[model samples]
Target: MGRVNTGPSDPTAPDHHEQGNPVTERVVAELVERSNTLGSDPRNTNFAGGNTSAAGTRTDPVTGGPVELLWVKGSGGDLGTLTEDGLAVLRLDRLRALVDVYPGEDREDEMVAAFDHCLFGKGGAAPSIDTAMHGLVRAAHVDHLHPDSGIALATAADGERLTRECFGDRVVWVPWRRPGFQLGLDIARIAEENPGAIGAVLGGHGITTWGATSQECQDHSLEVIRTAERFIAEHGRPEPFGPALEGYEPLPEEERRARAAALAPTVRGLASTDRAQVGHFTDTEEILDFLARAEHPRLAALGTSCPDHFLRTKVRPLVLDLPATAPLEQVVERLGELHVRYREDYRRYYEEHADADSPPMRGADPAVVLVPGVGMFTFGKDAKTARVAGEFYVNAVNVMRGAEALSTYRPIDESEKFRIEYWSLEEAKLRRQPAPKSLATRVAFVTGGASGIGRAVAERLAGEGACVVVADLDAEQAEKAAAEIGSADTAVGVACDVSDARAVTRALEQAALAFGGVDLVVNNAGLSISKPLLETTERDWDLQHDVMAKGSFLVSREAARMMTTQGMGGDIVYIASKNAVFAGPKNIAYSSVKADQAHQVRLLAAELGEHGIRVNGVNPDGVVRGSGIFAGGWGAQRAAVYGVEEKDLGAFYAKRTILGREVLPEHVANAVHVLTSGELSHTTGLLVPVDGGVAAAFLR
Candidate 1:
């Protein structure tokens, strides 16, 4: 098993990563542990959704005087992976003092800039917008969390009355307000007025709890959340979402997934109209349950109440109009019209609320789409984002269930959602994100990707930010190769016999669901039987042609069909060999199939040009070391033909080349990247040789 290396800076054991003094060190250690424990479970917090802090005294380096500091979760850091480095340590005295000169809620965005001056010496990380909430709360330790159970009570129509009934005076209730310096000050006042209260439910938001000690704070946080969950279970009404729609019930597991796969490209295409997007399909029980309910459409239209959620999931989802049991073709036919209607509705919403100072509409495309029988499909610029958005929506569904069980589910209105979605502060945060890699929004499929040249090609494309699907005849090895490359969001492995038309279609379906659709493909699956025409059996010729020439043809045809559905131009590259043009002894079958593959590249390029699909080829020579074809016994046979040992064949072949240099799998992979990099957009029917200067194999 592989292990992730953790060191001094890592806070796995509180003592390993310490602070200025024993007191400060102990507090910091507990803060990190509490944050990680709470963050690990989705029940406590969503990814990067909550904030935690510990207030303590630290020795000032220059003055040698005791200074009050606040160590809080910082911008863009997840609580599950919270380390000392992810915390922003600032002078509490300075941060609190800013309230005296505060310019009010209208100019609250300026207060974030002022936070820089409050850093205690060198700040650990940039303080998040929630810093004020943590700093101003009257306690040694504080937590601001968005637990589904807590949010349910927070967003209920009779939330204040229900909160009083649930916890009595232990947890008070605060009304809705956009988080800022003013909200922080407001929470501080509420805490002071209620001496018996341990926390407060922030209406239309989440929960906030505090304690004089770290353990007390965490215990209080969990107690509040657990109590809320139990209260809902005991007192909540049955069938809160209303009864299931008869024809919209979830389908069987296998059929559900198949339909999800079939519809992925069309849904992804509609979602990516403004810009290319990666998709995630979710079919959890809760998702299906919500979709089947009659009240879901009405609730989904109102959107999520929590700021953390709608920011990732968008203001609302695009619910499918047709029934879940509708035929695949029928659903596909109606999608275009449905997408246009959603776009127009979004445009009207923007125009109705946008002012002269508001930023231009970012996108009209829907980020989430609901399919009753199938599931939910969410889109983002990359896979991780898409997956997280889906998770947030699930949290929203749970909240709605609990809220509706208690009373009417009344979330925040559209005006507030609009203000937060297009907030100037939010825009600045987006601008700060790092630029995307060349193939950031692209997905690639590599044949024979379990080993050798195909594996190299898969790794190369993945490094450039393309989601990769490794397809090979060996199912086990294909999955292993994918795991080594990255997580499921970045890569997946599938077993495929490229020459079989049905198998090829199934593989394409997998790709469509895994990542909206394919943007690039490399046809590199092949094997060689080194024998003269007279000595070669019919089986040898058939195997070579089936895997190389015919296999490339089938994969290309299927990929092209899916790409056309996506309405996105794509790339198809064939890893042909130099022997396609050069004749050599005892290589009749291998060379003939390569020649067939080379011709297919030209044929497809001419035919696919109208669709903006670029078909190209990379021809390599003497890939002896680290080659799957050679490892399968071709190396020994080729050595015998040249009167040399198996290991010496590589050196012999290299010495004969014009440049006397060896060619490796990576060199061929580089040529594929060059062709599909979008730099040579107009270049097709082109073959680049990675043969170390082979004059005989050179294209005329």
Candidate 2:
């Protein structure tokens, strides 16, 4: 027997039982624990890819009677973090009966409807498509996983023979079949025939194991993995030589990031049809090692190791020979041509295998992109999805590598891949997803986003479907802010003191690399130095100008250059202040710089207008809440200067405005969104006042 590596040891002792509903609770807990065990390792599962189930009992909501239930992981639920609610309960008997009534033709639509009808309760979630297979097995617990170890064997040219040799008669081997009612029926028949079999290895799919309890099921699954590992260890071929690159040295971190930034817009544009897509570049050792191999092209062309991966990674990746020093324009043009070719090839593949009954297929866009000298870039409708796809492809690389080491790697035929790719059931998952936000395809780069108006703008942009880069002088705070604004692939944090041109350039590069270029730039980073002209030293004036005036200029210049290179119009909104128009006593340092920055915006608008760039400014007063400067004692000091109590300062500013409303960071953010969203497309080089109708600060 092979030993399993169960990962880090838990200091706490394991609990054997749960506190509620004895059997149901215990089963659910076991399912969760074991699923987490498998899922904690990406080599086992990616995102919400794999599934598990347990047989239990539930009261039928309609009949108010007991019903045999199969609780299976539902759609869009991650196994690693699964909960009771994530597992949908369905009538086991009803699910099994569907197999007998399932028509010979593709009945995915009917099967899904039947599954919905067989729910044990009114609001019960939809069960996995493999729910029937779980019901057919005699065991009380079952798990179907896409672990890399098992897939390495499963995708081999003679996987069945290898599996039989590895496990003797303990495991059953089933040929490739579409996952649905038919596959469920086949699994049941195979289990019945192979009595005492611990699991079934499905060709080009994954492994399924079952037992009386979750522990037994987990043990069997691990045992199968160990067996495959041992088999590969014994029969593996010599490692292939890597491609020769005479003078190729990995680019420095800064240069690599810059290259990614320049390449992102092109990748996003090529991947997009109606809207832009998010792009993520991953350069893990596994990806780099795989790409370095001489035989990478042949192995990568073999398709995904499993059928389920088709939905996330597509059938094949788009391979590019991107030299580190390639010109951005040339790279864009080359990718455009390759994209057209990729689409044409996909159409041909679809037509060759798609039957008249098949549902309309999605556009032929490559999800996984491979750049020989750079890294692997994955594209998705959003950042989270792109990250998920990238992770899956990385796992695929490991699996393929192992399979090749053992023998010739093979995957399901193109016809089978086509069925799963275009399956109504698979496509329904995407269809059922709620529509993305209006700014879904756009990316925004916000400076000083750790707090204040910058943070508000970041949150607002993410809410509207734009991925964001939260740039701040404090790296730790920036990352924390990014975490708070988390919406999977939506935001990333980068340390940037906007005063430094190098830091400003890197921040923009990071944004481009994270989300495939910048469509929106919020130049909101600034500092307030409250002092009389006599008290304000040369240091104070330089610091204020560096951030407010020079910083804004540098960031805007870099962003506009990227936008122009992409040939896509973009928006740059300068977060100026009411101080820009109305000077405050002892605030010359802040007021003078703000005034300079406002004119800089107009100058940029004039110069960049020819390149389809829109530059505008928003001037707001008295946004104390969550304002960094205010929180740093400026609020109290300002109140003292105005001869008002600190507690009454907010009210004072509110009543000072004609609208009698407190100006807020969100209000300023709203104004920025309006200009960036093209609601004011015809308007630019104008100042919008967000100071609660302040007459002195009003734009005429």
Candidate 3:
């Protein structure tokens, strides 16, 4: 490397001149704040001490030539409170070019020449060691802080390599070197190479990344530190630490159950994961208490697990005990509001970067770090969870320590960070694998498959490689439907009235004989009566119940028998209706029968949960759009019953949901697909809302 001369003065001394751009000003300001904080520390930290700088193009009013250098603290000044005037500018390109071809020679002369080339910006001090690297970040705003966690990681042998192995694909890593123009230029080159990289791990240094906005840059920094902390926790050798948090306890069972039922779906919607570790710390009393028992006490030693956690949980948690002066409902309500805000912000971010090929992935959590007395909670979707929290705690300590040991830490710039945050390529890597398409070769029987949702579901199941038997009231229609299914080798059509036990039993036998053994059963065949509650006669109720409710019971019992006899777990899907809960107009008989379907599915799920026979229901909201039901003026009747104009029925019905779109047969089919595909192996007794946002209206 070319010799880069250093002044006897602190290399990171600040400059008084105003740098162009608001973003740059803000970044410089944060650096100044960080520097002031560090200087105040008694240790008088160096590289481990805080450092700050400005990079990217600034047309020199005098020379018009771009002058780039890694800027840092000048000799005598404590960076803790260094202002722009304290900044020292240097020429980084000159130093890097010299290092490119040193020819195993001494570089003292080159260093002297480069030093002479440095500009003091009219009475400003000479550039710091960080000038060169800072100059090369290419982002208008660049802030570097030595988080303790990063320092610890860097201090380890092969820290750079290890960091790379942990966060390699997600972040860039650069080798450590003296903080100067040569290092800055080399890092700049790396930044240039990775135009989309959000941040980088400085091999033995810190982290560097840019942003179009300060918040974006800050977010990048937080994410990088969090990722590093997680890595160290998983891979770093563990040393004994104090106890885990004391007085810290899991949420009470009743409150937890109530909250989970009300909020977990929202959580799952955001995080999109079934497995989660939720630790509830009621008060600040437990924040430090956990350290005594924790495997790694260092994580608990700090106020926030890591620097970035400040964004999620605000530095530290609030401490409290039970008898919480606040009402339970009030606490829950506040948490719900926070969740909404978090999701809204996340959505805004998505909208800003969404494109045709890659629409943004929506997260369900409100990202609040729940602190009861100090109410806060974090929602992690995908892999973030507490995993990120634990990692951030440890990594921040490591980096902070390292930065103090040296003089500064380095990371990628903010613009680069933004790119990575919004990168279509990176986003593609984080998608949840799709639910399976079909139930494979599992055999299924769909009663009333001649038409409607049952037929549609049967077609879908058949398409998914299921051996489907189309059982219907009309034998000819059943055979025709089977022929249309085109699963000649796997599907068979049979005539049977589901409400008739003998007929259903005979059909079951024929299907089992045909497909070896039945594995799935769709209890969909049904009849409906649209009488008022007072108008609903006993006979009407009996017919609807026997067809919709009892039929499901009998079919399920037989299917379970077959599944258990074959010693293979199976899935059962029931076709229910939104009317089970949402009473629409005067259809008392239909509503009553539909409610029974929901109960049947739930009962089956509860009974068969141990038998390994999963039961689920698809409560179709409005499948009339592409069906015979729609053409028969049912919409008009529904609109009339709901006291709405017929012309605005779809929009009226749609108003009940957040998605505001009419439910489609395919949408219902998709839900069925999940239930039957084994993707929902752990899911049972659940009613998945296919209603755009209608259910949400009532839920909120």
Which runs of model 1 end up more than 4 angstroms from their true locations?
A: 1-20
Clashes of 1: 0
Runs of candidate 3 with Cα error greater than 4 angstroms are 1-438, 628-636, 643-652, 696-700
lDDT of 3 by residue, 57-170 (tens): 344567765444444454334455576677665554554454444333223223423554655355556544455455446664455555555554554455665666766766
Q: Give the Cα error of residue 216 in candidate 3, in Å.
A: 80
Q: Evaluate model 1: give its TM-score.
A: 0.96
- Provide C-alpha RMSD values for all models, in order: 5.5, 5.6, 21.5
Which candidate leads in lDDT? 1
Candidate 2 per-residue lDDT, tens place, 273-339, comes to 5446777888777776666567777877776858667678998998765554667677777788888
Comparing candidate 2 with candidate 3, which one achieves the higher lDDT? 2
The global C-alpha lDDT for each of the candidates, from Candidate 1 onward, is: 0.89, 0.78, 0.56
User: Lowest summed lDDT over 10 consecutive residues: which window, candidate 3?
Assistant: 274-283
Model 2, stretches more than 4 Å misplaced? 1-20, 58-66, 240-258, 322-333, 354-361, 531-537, 583-586, 610-612, 677-683
Write one digit per residue (lDDT tens) for candidate 1, span 1-700: 1111111111232322224567668888999999999888888888989899998776676776756778999988898999989999888778878877788788988999998889876748898888888887768889999999999999999999999999999999999988777778778888878979999899999999998878899999999999999999999999999998988899999999989988998999899999999998999999999999999999999889899999998889999877888988989888888899999999998998899988889999999999889999999989999999999999999999999999989999888998989988888999899899888989999999999999999999999999999999998999999999999999999999998989988888888888878989999999988998799999999998999988999999999988888888899999998998999888999999999999999999999988889999999997998899899999999999999999898898899898898888888889999999888998999989898888999898
Estimate TM-scores for all models.
0.96, 0.91, 0.37
